[model samples]
Target: MSILVYINSNGNKIAKNSFEAVTYAKKLGDVTVVTNGKADNTILADLGKYGASKVLVDRSFDGTDEQQITRMVATAAEKVGAETVVFSDDLVGKAVAPRLSVKMNAGLISSATGVPQGDGTVPVNVFSGKAFAFVKANTSKKIISLLPNSIPVEEVGGSASIEEFNGNAGDTRVRVKGINRPEGDIPLPEAELVVSAGRGLKGPENWGMIEDLAKALGAATACSRPVADADWRPHHEHVGQTGVAIRPNLYIAIGISGAIQHLAGVNGSKTIVVINTDKEAPFFKAADYGVVGDAFEVVPKLVEAVKKFKASN
Candidate 1:
């Protein structure tokens, strides 16, 4: 079987999730990596360390125009003779995978987590990451979109041989006029720890405490849906059913009432901490640790304690 994985390079390096996708691609057969635009050949070569045998480049896919990418991927897949195509189920993959699947008549498994079982069966979460489903594509072509943080990236030592697969990519109707990046070193969803606030923070101005705590703990900062929608926080920092979902190692909620939609997103965290003045807030029910207190006063103390702990160590 010839398997190919799409590589979303982060600068000269491949995105972390792409590494996980490459890890999965390595299992099926000779793995080939497809990248867009010009990237450091050294970065493409490093993919060999993750089990890729070939690398294909298509410069046109670098633009955010979805059609350009769809055409490029479609053309690249055919050129590589790939039976299976792997992608990280992040923003870019979500935009491109379905179109590629339709163009190739390939079976698609979006948000797939585990490795394929016998007979091309892979597992995916259903009902908004609430249920399980097993899927098997009977067709010869298969498309697998892997969830970030779903699998560990495997490392091997050896440079992958670079190869060029040529095609005249099509034009995209939609174009990216510009790009807006989020501020901060820690990516919230991918952070190991997260500190969030809700209506109880009173308003966005109070976010300073949450930000301080997050910085101290090397954690990400987020807000409840209402707070974000209210423009108290950036939409990117919102976490809930209708917003971003995360499964950080530790989730700290300050002043959140923990409605079902809100909890659904954070329940996957390994540990949950709730801080609210109201003991009866629904968030307490799901919290591993609860502190019934004012966030303003309690947050400062918590920050001091975490800072002290760091200093002590």
Candidate 2:
């Protein structure tokens, strides 16, 4: 089977989830990656390390126009005669996958957690990570949006042939405006380690501890919806059902009472550590490790420990 994998890059670097998608697609068939915007040849070729056989660079589009992207992907898939199309279950994937599915008359499997089984059924995350379900696509063409961090990435050691794709990007309706991004060391969705907090820290003045811990651990910083709503943190940092969803390797919650809406976004984390004074906080049930203590006392010690460990190592 021939597979077409759609990836997005931040001008200079490719997103980690895209690499995971490429790796996942490789397991099913020969992988061809399509990306837009300007990037270095070396950066585009790096997809091969994750099993991409070829990289198609389309410079016609610079920004994410979902409609245009759908058209480009459909055109590329048709050109390559791809039977399966793979995407990372990110914002771009969520927007474009359905459009491409309808355009190609293909079956879509969103939130695929694993590769296809022997019986052609795919495992998927259902009910907000509370359960798993298997889905099958009876159509000749299939589209899959893989959940981030569900698949491990490996380097197979080869460079993919880079080629220019002249696919139609459709009409441009969206105008380009200046982008205002939150200041941070790492993007939250792509971070492997994330340190988040809620109102339990008292006020925004106490946020230093959270930043200190995140910096020491080389982690991204996040906040609960209430924190963001109260203007203690940027809306971009909010992680919850009404905010950005993440599936980091390790998630550290400080002073945040775990609400169900908040858990919906972070429940997919591989390891969760909750620190709250109240032992009865709902987040503890979801945490792999729970510490009942005051953030004022516990956070400093944790920061010191992380710093000392880093120094020793």
Candidate 3:
């Protein structure tokens, strides 16, 4: 079987999600990587290390208009005679996979956690990570969007040759301007660990300890829905059913009562740690590790412990 995997780059570097997707696709069969925009020599070498047999760079993508880009990728998959195509279940994958499915008349599965089974079925999370649903496509060709961090990134012995493909970009309706990123802030979707707080900290003035602990752990800082709604934190930092959904390796909740909506967003986390003064807080029910204590007393010691560990190591 031949598989075509889409690799999304962050400037000249490959995103972790795309790497995970590539690593997952390598297990299936022969893998071909298709990248949009410009890819540096360093990134191409990294793809070869991850087992990409051939890398097709599409410079005509122009990084705008998902519709036009989807057409380009679909055409490339056809040219390569790919039986299956894979993508990282991120913003770009979410936008392009369904379109490709329509264009190729193939089966499309999003947020898939595993590779195809013997019956061509894939497992995906249902009901906000509450359960698993098996999905299958009746079509001969299939498209899959793998969830980030669901599969470990393993290196296989292989090398890839780079090839350039100038695709039909079509009429560009959007214009590129500039990107604005805040300094020292990690994108929650890509963070391996996240430390989040709620109103239990009292007010926004008391968020220093949370930030300090997150900084010490090299984790992203998140907030509950109420915290963002009340303007204590930005909306981007909010995690819940109504906010951002995250699937980090470790999730630490400070002073936040576990509402079902909040749990829905982070239930995909590999491990959950909840710290709250209220012993009756609902969050403890879902926590892998629960500590009944005040944030003021607990966070400082946790930060100190992290600092001490780092210093010793």
Candidate 4:
């Protein structure tokens, strides 16, 4: 089967989820990656380590407009005679996959957790990670938007041939005014470990402990919706049904009461550790480990413990 993977790049580097998507596609058949923007050939060639055989770089479009990106992907799929097209289940994927499916008349599996089974069915998260449902593509062409961190990325160790794709970039309807990136060592969506807090921290002044803990563990920082709504933290830090959904390897939620809406976003994490003073906090029921304690006392000690472990090692 011929496979085409659409990857997102930051002009200099490719997103981690995109590598996972390429790795996933490699399992099915020959993989070709399509990306836009100005990136070095070395950066594009690095995808070979993750199983991509070829890469199509389109410098004509910078990926500022989703419509143009959709067109670029469709054209590349046709050029490669791709039977399967894969994308990372991110903002870019969510916006373009549906449009590409419509244009190509392909069956789309959004938020796919795994590759197709022997029965040709794909498993996907449903009801906000509460359950799993299998879907099959009845069409000749198939499109899948894979969830980030669902598949572990492995380096197969090979180099891919790079070529320029001269495709048409449709007129842009959206214009960029400025770019305000979130502050963090790792972007929350791509982070393997995350340290998050809620209103129980009391105020923005108390966030120093959260940052200290996150720094110690090399984890990204997040907050509950209420904390972001109250301006105690930036909205980008909010994670919930109505905010950013994450599936980090480990999620340490401190002081969060874990409302159903909040759980909707983070329940996909591989491991959850909840720390709250209320023993009956809803988050504890979903957490793999629960610590019934006050954040003021627990967080400082936890930070010290992590620091000591690092020092000893």
Candidate 5:
């Protein structure tokens, strides 16, 4: 089967989730890449490492106008005779995949865990990742929005040829004025390992312990809703039902009692570790591992352990 993989980039280079998407697409069959703008040559070159045979760059895509971009993708799929179209279930994928599915009269399986097996059955997480369900598409064409970090990125090291395509991006509406990204080494949503704290940390002044542990673990730092509401942390750092949802490999919660709302956001994580002074903390029930201890004492030791391990290794 010929596959068309949407190459979602940050305009500078490939997005991490896009790399996973391309790697997943490569497993199905011959893979071609589609990008929005004229990315740097160095960025395009990295597509080769992931087994993309060809790269189609559309400069007309002004990074806005979903209708126009959908048309551009549909046209490309037709040109390549692609039976399957794959996307990373990121911001762009969430917006455009459904539109493209409607335009092409194709079946869409969002948050897919893996490629479709024989009988076209695909596995997906349901109900905030509390359960797994197998889904199948009856349509001739299939569009998949694979969940981030679900599939490992494999490098076949096959170089891809760059080709430019001319297309109409249609009316220029909904233009982005500017982006003010929060300063951090890791973006929370994309982080594989996340270290989050709650009200148990006391105040923002006592956040040094949390930061030290997070730094040692090389994980993104996050907070519960109340922590953000209290202005101890930025609102963008909040993770809950009303905030950003994450499905990281490892999530370590310190001090914050696991409220139902907070659990709603982080329930998708593969493993949860809760460290709370309250043995009755609700979060302990959901945790794969639990530590009933004070954050001030436990966190410092944890940091030292991580440091010592790194030094020894």
Candidate 6:
């Protein structure tokens, strides 16, 4: 009765959220990882740092159809005698877990935010992370999807032992469509600190200062939903109820008036700092710290302060 984690093959390295899943899995059983690409041992080495003891390498781990991959993992799960299969609550994980649970006739718990006890009960939050509840599995096999950013990763040890899966990858129906990414070195959804703007930025051409602040702090850049709707920023950069929900350690909202929908998405951040000229803006109530001043005037000075702070440190 061990916990088995399915690590995603994102680019050459592993997915950041998968690391959190590994951390959660290690607590329940022997940590095992599955990789689908021809990544070298170095890629697996990082996983080892976070306590993954073994990595199962599969040539067919590609973005094949759900039917084939579910079978492949299910076969491996049965062979390994994994009583419980854990997956990160990601796009791919959300898609595959239910199917895998149904195919294996296992109990399914999606969006689990905490570790499960030896018992069948799993804890989850509801009402937009406002409340907690325990979910119990009905079957012998329990499959759980863990939410991202719920658990922090700690490097206990183990680079990972690489093994091969005896499955063919050609049977999947889904094919790779296309991949798109941000312009900078960091992906915002995964960043610890995020420097974001809203429609208050006026135009996209004025984004240089925003980028400068983000670059200085090694943070990701983001914008409000309206900015994305206005085409001032990419839809990918939009953060709100209809957009991405971020849980960064620090989030700076420059010129954003802070709507209820926007607050719903960003309320998960550890610390929120809002900068706007309107003193009575709704965002101020939700902000951990706020500055009631124009962004154009305040942003440059704030950027300088951050630079000085970093330099002094």
- Indicate the worst ten consecutive residues by lDDT in candidate 4: 166-175
User: Which residue runs does candidate 2 get wrong by more than 4 Å?
Assistant: none
Clashing pairs in 1: none
Instruction: Record all residue pairs in model 5 with backbone atoms less than 3 Å apart, i.e. clashing.
Output: none
Residues 61-128 of candidate 6 have per-residue lDDT tens digits of 56636666677778768667888888887777878899999888998998788887667578875555
Model 2 residue pairs with clashes: none
Candidate 6 residue 282 Cα shift, in angstroms, is 2.1
- Writing each residue's lDDT as its tens digit, candidate 4 over 166-237 gives 757677888888888888679989999999999899999999999999999999999999999999999998
The predicted structure with the larger TM-score, 3 or 5, is: 5
lDDT of each: 0.83, 0.93, 0.87, 0.94, 0.87, 0.81
Clashing pairs in 3: none
Better of 1 and 4 by TM-score: 4
Q: Whole-model lDDT for model 5 versus the true structure?
A: 0.87
**lDDT of model 3, residue 92:** 84
Q: Tens-digit lDDT track for model 3 on 1-313?
A: 7899987776686777887888888888888988777778567867877878898877866474678778777877887899999998887888889988998999988889998789878999889999999999889999999988798888886678888886554667778788665345688888999999999999999999999999999999999999999999888899999988899999999999999999999999999999999999999999999999989999999999999999999
lDDT of 1: 0.83
TM-score of 2: 0.98
Model 2 lDDT tens row, 194-230: 9999999899999999999999999999999999999
TM-score, one value per model: 0.89, 0.98, 0.95, 0.98, 0.95, 0.91
- For residue 114, give model 4's deviation from the true position in Å: 0.6
Q: Number of backbone collisions per candidate, in order?
A: 0, 0, 0, 0, 0, 3
Q: Which stretches of candidate 6 lie over 4 Å from their true place?
A: 117-120, 168-170
Question: Candidate 6 vs. truth: CA RMSD?
Answer: 2.1
